[model samples]
Target: MRVARTHHRCARRSVVVGKPKAEPRASWVDEETFDAKKKRASLILRRLEKQYPDTRTALNYTTPFELLVATVLSAQSTDKMVNIITEKLFQKYRSPEDYLKAKPGELEQDIKASGFFNQKAKSIRGLSQKLVEDFGGEVPGTMEELLTLPGVARKTANVVLGNAFGKNFGIAVDTHVHRLSWRFGFSDHDDPNKVEQDLMKLFSRAKWFKVSHLLIDHGRNVCFARNPNCADCVVNELCPAARVPAVRKRAKPSPSA
Candidate 1:
């Protein structure tokens, strides 16, 4: 009887210990085709447009030249901070010629609150000099010409082109746009240029400019970097990462009474 009871307990222990583990569900993005992703991207854009009606650059600017200077100063700084600095800076330096006239150190001191003051000051002075010398003291409207200016990459160029000139060259992949793109499975790339390319392919040219603004607004209000408000996300249903349940550790069994 003791031997029989020992065998019964051993079998029960084996059964409990040998239970099969559950397989992880495939990511929603993994199952989607190119056409499906495109369609989903369109749906996401439509929803986002409804959520944020006003799509505009947060940086305050009156002229294309002011917008260009503000964008240059906006690198590695917040729009609020840039706007604060630009308010006074704009009043002082009205044109590219004015910026060119100011000394780099004086300009650095003027924009010290924007962070990266020295580099920003140099870019401002360098680009201002270029604008005066090459483009007749005017901010160029074309992407090609804009790239020729110092500190004017695709992001800054796109911002100026889209907001100032009402042109859509490409999506401006800022920090907000970058984070949301990966979460939405629009782009797996870490590089901003590649991410912008992916977005351009996923969305139509008409939406190229407004898409960045929508994503930026959403990122700020909902999809935060550290703690995304997935529950209230506008695109939660379409998001692949949204369906994936957050993994939590199982509690250890307490000591038997």
Candidate 2:
């Protein structure tokens, strides 16, 4: 069992920006030739691959259904918190039928520690009900089918498809992925979907699944959203954001001075 204390996201947490979110391109990610950008992306991944060879989703789950629930619970919260909640949660409700049996607001209190419990509870129960009514209680495997579930966006769908189903439909851009993608100059756009597209263009289809996991591991351990540990980052040399700052020009003295 993974202990809550072992998860780095719990040590440092950030709120989730709402979906269809828009974040402007980082100025550091200056315009470059596509070939140049892709090469840098490849080299960064090569170094990070060595740095975080064992990276995987930090959330604990044995089944696709469990992953779905844990991911929905992970929004605006840490994976450690989600794991703690699910440690008991998975034991109590093992199937879609079980979640549908929860009374209104009952599951909310159970998941309150994950934050935004009200919406998260609604999403869980709603998706579980859909799974029972539509998919014969099995979590749908395709991106299209998974998106039909209440809390399943592309990011969530990507996580389920890539990790749980072992299909590389796309890269899952969580907060960590979003931040690191920009820092690594993988994608300039902050919109997760767009960022996913930009990144998909960089790497081959086979490595798509590994991209997010690698970046996320790097983000938690090194390239943080605030005061990132650039000095120790594995790909710092390739990271435009981590480059040594250009010397600032001296300001002209005022005429009076």
Candidate 3:
């Protein structure tokens, strides 16, 4: 899929208008009323939509079960890595029963590159067994049911619900979403669950699914954990963390006449 380029039209709004542009104040964001936060979040989303129109879950999957397994492997590992492993992994195990049939040690080795392979292997097998036994070999659609699967948490559940089932129960607060939430002033807490709640309150339920993808895309491409590319950020003006000045270049001394 072709990812959209960073549109300059979106960047224009990110620049502060006046000389000595005022730095974004986190304290001001802390004091913002619900209405103000909602408005700011709407603007941020609009700009992000323009910047990354192709935002999506980077995990490669053709089925809900495939997505569930891929998401489980994605924990503590990059999506690119997970995709690489799943390319071969999916070709072998196409169903929950297939996973359940595999020997633990063999399955562990299959996804070992994803890191924490033992725990992840246990989760995948355990959840697959549960799916076959309880949910009739299908990944559950509801949050409550999905959470019952071993290793499934709100983050994973939200991901499956929104992306797999087309149900927007809540925003999936993965590492990227968690960081962007704080940077965007949507939440003050570091807890993913609390951050997810704050974001749900700030944006409409209809936007919950796309919100995670947009923030994830922006976080990966621009709002990095260290030294964020604030100048290039599409929502820099609306981002509370964009207060930091961009990296400056020193001019070379004029060559002696």
Candidate 4:
């Protein structure tokens, strides 16, 4: 009887341990035709728009220079924290000259709470110097110009261009953008730049700026990094990564209004 009871318990344990609730998927990258991908992507964006109409960067800044600084500080930090740090940083350093003029080690101290203050300080100073000398103290609006700034890359460049300068050279693939891109099967790449390319293929140039914002808003509100509220997602049926069973077929994508 003891042997039988032990066997029964082990059987129960094996059943529970071997099973998972569900797996997230991302298979449409190569499966869908280019036109179908565009249609689905358009549908996804429209639904996201309905829920998050005022899609924009969460960072707080009043000018291009301020926006540039805020985007720089946002690295390895949350927008809320960046905003908190910038609330004071912006008031003190109004232009590239102001950052450059900060006493040695003073800029680091000012942004120490933002974390990685030393490297951030150097990047800020280096970019400030460049902006002052090369660009006449104004943040450059073009992608090529923004890329040349110290501590700036495609992501930061896109943010500055789209939000600050109203240009949509490319999408900004921050962590949220990166996550949602794969979930939506927009890109199979792990690299943000590569992912941005895949995303660029799915939308018109005019929509590039808005796509980044829409994905970011949905990621923050519903598709969390953990325990995402899939059932409540605006495009759950279209998302392979959703924990629930998907409709498993394409629906007629609505035209963009």
Q: Each model's C-alpha lDDT?
A: 0.78, 0.80, 0.79, 0.78
TM-score of each: 0.84, 0.85, 0.84, 0.84
lDDT for 172 in candidate 2 is 87
The best candidate by TM-score is: 2
Instruction: Give one digit per residue, the lDDT tens place, for model 2 in 83-185.
Output: 9999999999989999888887789889999998998888998999899999999988899999999988998899889878789999888777888776676
Q: Select the stronger candidate by TM-score from 1 and 3.
A: 3
Candidate 4 per-residue C-alpha lDDT over 1-257 given as tens digits, one digit per residue, 9 for 90 to 100 = 01110000000000001111144585555587878878989999989989987777787777877777877887777777777788788789878888878999999989988788999899999999999899988888899998999999998899889987789899988777777777777776767788889899999999999998888788777887677788688798878677765344569999999
Worst 10 residues of 3 by lDDT: 8-17
Highest lDDT model number: 2
Compared with the true structure, what per-residue lDDT tens digits does model 3 show for residues 156-179?
898888877789999988776777
- For candidate 1, give the lDDT: 0.78
lDDT of 1 by residue, 55-162 (tens): 667878878888888888777777777777887998999988887788647898999998889898888888989999999888889999999998889999998899
Backbone clashes, each candidate: 0, 0, 0, 0
Q: Residue 36's C-alpha lDDT in candidate 3?
A: 89
Error of 1 at 49 (Å): 0.4
Please list all clashing residue pairs in model 2, or write none if there are none: none
For every candidate in turn, the CA RMSD to the true structure comes to 19.3, 8.4, 8.7, 15.6
Q: What is the lDDT of residue 153 in candidate 4?
A: 91
Q: Model 2: what TM-score? A: 0.85
